[model samples]
Target: MTRKAAGNAPGHAAGNEAGEETGEEPGEEPGAAHWLFGDQLGPHFIDPARGGPRRDAPLLMIEARSVLRRRRFHRAKAHLILSAMRHRAAELGDRVRYVKADTYRQGLREAVGDARVTVHHPTSHAALAFVRSLPSVRVLSARGFLVTHDAFGRWADGRGTKHLRQEDFYRWVRQTHDLLMEGDQPAGGRWNLDHDNRQPPPRGATDLGVPAPYRPRESEIDDEVRADLDRWSRDGDVEFVGEDGPRGFPATRREALAALHRFIEHRLPTFGAYEDAVLTGDATMSHSLLSSSLNLGLLDPAECAERAEAAWRSGDVPLNSAEGFVRQITGWREYVWHVYWHFGTRYRESNTLGHHEPLPDWFTDLSPDGTDANCLSHVLRQVRDTGWTHHIPRLMILGSLALQRGWEPGAVTDWFHRSFVDGYDWVMVPNVVGMSQYADGGRMTTKPYTSGGAYINRMSDFCGPCRYKPTVRVGEDACPFTAGYWNLLHHHRDRFEHNPRMTQAVRGLDRLTDLEALLEQERDRRD
Candidate 1:
């Protein structure tokens, strides 16, 4: 629950008695007046304004889990959370129950009766805020990252706010549970082998281990969500992608553990080199698709990293693969979450570079024409279809292009949030807008990562059939990505010019001029 230190500020939106938005404004502080928590905002922060519990009746609340990807399952977390709520409410035979973010508003408390009502939360943040909102209602934390009230800034010490440089919290997680960190050194002889696993996978390699997917049958509440999703589609374009099985998700801890083990033994070996490599139909790279489970509290971060460490120790996977995977969990993933919250809602709105370029059309298209050669058409297709993209394409290509083109950091974050299956507000805001876009002034990553076609070609097979050539740096056949990379450095030379690690890239840029217009023509018209 948010502490009510109500000192009215200038830009705080004023909440009216009748009916107006009640949320933190885009440019305003998050006060009780004008902030309207609604559809467009993340589902995590959509509940009642932070207050306390309610004085009501009937103590049954249900949380149904669903993954909404306009891509495969017409999947939306909205469907799962609300559907489970509905099913549980119906099972208990209660009408005063059932709170769905998809179909309800924040006024549930004001409108509900004396009997205690139930509200469904798609994420831990939503649940925490919901509990904080009620006066006499029950509260529950998600099995996963639902830590809202207890704002645990792992990076922050007793001091004001601290930047998490080392893997302290992650180390504690390993030490506390006695995970993979084992050896004469710490837990193991070494802490991580991420740096060791950088060797590229054997080219033209096809040792991809088969990945299993679960598609569950629609249970009781799914009918309601399906109905809502169908209705939603009539208004615009919402595709339906669902799994076909009994209970689609890995409901318990065991299934999630199995998923992790599979990655450790089979996938971890090749994860690092190919972590950035994209291939057609290779949805799950050597990487483990465990973010959803981790976010939902289905798996522990320490446990996950340790398992990868175990893979390396057992020789099931290489050190580089293990270390790289561990870095994603310990370094990147947690760092992004911390940065997002530290920056707060404003993090998503940051545009420190002042770039207003719209995201390129290729971002929303299927073909590779006029697209950045290092781009992932499939991943972009996935984003548009299901709201999800794999890490490499999302980070390297998508993020790289955004940095190169000078798109508003906020817009890029929104695209990632709106279009990814795993796009939680805490995660997406920082990674996309702050880290990848460098809108946060190098908070999470080393630099803006403004790269071009050459980087893409080095990592993936997506460029082979691409409309443009990755090799060409100028003129018609020149890959837009190639020129874009140089142009980004050229345009932002003063910024990245002195960056020591960026020196090599700056040297590469030395060949190009500040003529971004000509660069654009070289890329855009390259047939």
Candidate 2:
């Protein structure tokens, strides 16, 4: 990876002797064992210029079964992470010392003894604190993002904390990186084409009609992973949720690259228009299924954004499509990563909404028995079967339901982290706590993202055959979402009454003549 692509700055402590900083440049220390986390499998982690894992730096990889034992992760999520780590080990062959132990500490003791180890910055606060506490390891700057941590800190510091908006941050990133730019101006004369990307799915279409996404073929390595997962379950060592079907995402560098190429060549053109739309029959849509690859560190965000811009410049894809896709990686993805750290560890506990209800068994298990609401039921089933759904269903369908029901923000965040294939602590905390649940009280977003069935009916095909009517909210056939949306607003009326953005929604609540009956119905609702 290029120096510019990794967004790395010099002088990030490379070690020669246990916790002692070397005077040499990053990754240049000889005899330092380069430890690879599951999320840091890309070549940039060991790039000699970045730090000196040199051409032949010894590698340490630990597969701790306790990660699965501690939390009941989706079966596919467990399989994908382990497969990616094992695949990297197989690629490195003799250079890598792969150790499987019950805990990271145990694995480290078994693999490295007393040797000095250099590891890139871990993704979670817990992991970072643990590594910093370890005297035998040196932590380096994070990889796979477009902006450096220090750069983001400087930017955040310049702006006041509560008012740091994503649009402003996105524009700054575009200007700094010259992404989708025409000299000094943004291409197409606008920074965001989100308006163009909001169109609903094509009429009467079962799917997007685009070519299918790339799905990796399982090898013997996959067989071994499945067998081991099954064995662990049988022996009561680990537990998993969801179905363990054939692997659906890229697990190795080569496979990741292939997936990216397929997305760029076939799906990116129509990606922007229906980016937020959903088809019940089609889960993939025109979306790039590269989140798993990107989060796994198999692909760099800078590289991904640059390629999309290149496609626009070459006229292979429209400006909106390229710009929209670029904004995801360079703008939104990067913003969340920075926010996760800047918000501090206590951000997870922010519950301005004071929602303390626990999750229902059906919701936690991803069972359709939870609700007759077609959108919620279908989305849950999709996650149960595939460990994924596009972001719209995630935010609008699943998250919206949780918000309306007043589920605790931390529990919602953990559920998201445990369920999705691309989920990580850093990714889900900001997304669920701030964006999805609005529990941060306008920190990451302007307002709560919950909506009634009308929005869902407009954006997706799931409402057509739904047993509940989108327009009705006072009968047995009343849509849970339509009722829940107003019920939530009514319940929080004092909070929404003065906010300019919510005036229309708040006023609509006053027009509900059946408000008492609706409240009574929703209060007694179990399904």
Top candidate on TM-score is 2
lDDT of 2 by residue, 1-527 (tens): 12222233321221211223234454356788888999998877777775546677788999998889879999999999999999999998999999999999999989888788888878888898999899999777667776767667667776777787999889888887778887779998999999999999889999988999999999899999999999999998888899989999999999999999999989999999999999998999999999999899898776788778788888999988998898898889888987888888899999998899999999899897688888888899999998999899999999998899999999999999999999999999999999999999988998899898999999999888999999999898899899999999998999988878898999998788999999999878744
* TM-score of candidate 1 relative to the true fold: 0.70
Residue 138 shift from truth in candidate 2, angstroms: 0.7
Runs of candidate 1 with Cα error greater than 4 angstroms are 1-97, 100-155, 158-163, 166-178, 183-190, 206-224, 235-258, 261-266, 269-273, 302-322, 360-374, 513-527
TM-score on alpha carbons, each prediction: 0.70, 0.95
Global Cα lDDT for candidate 2 = 0.86
Give candidates' CA RMSD values in order.
9.7, 3.1
Q: Against the true structure, whose lDDT is highest?
A: 2
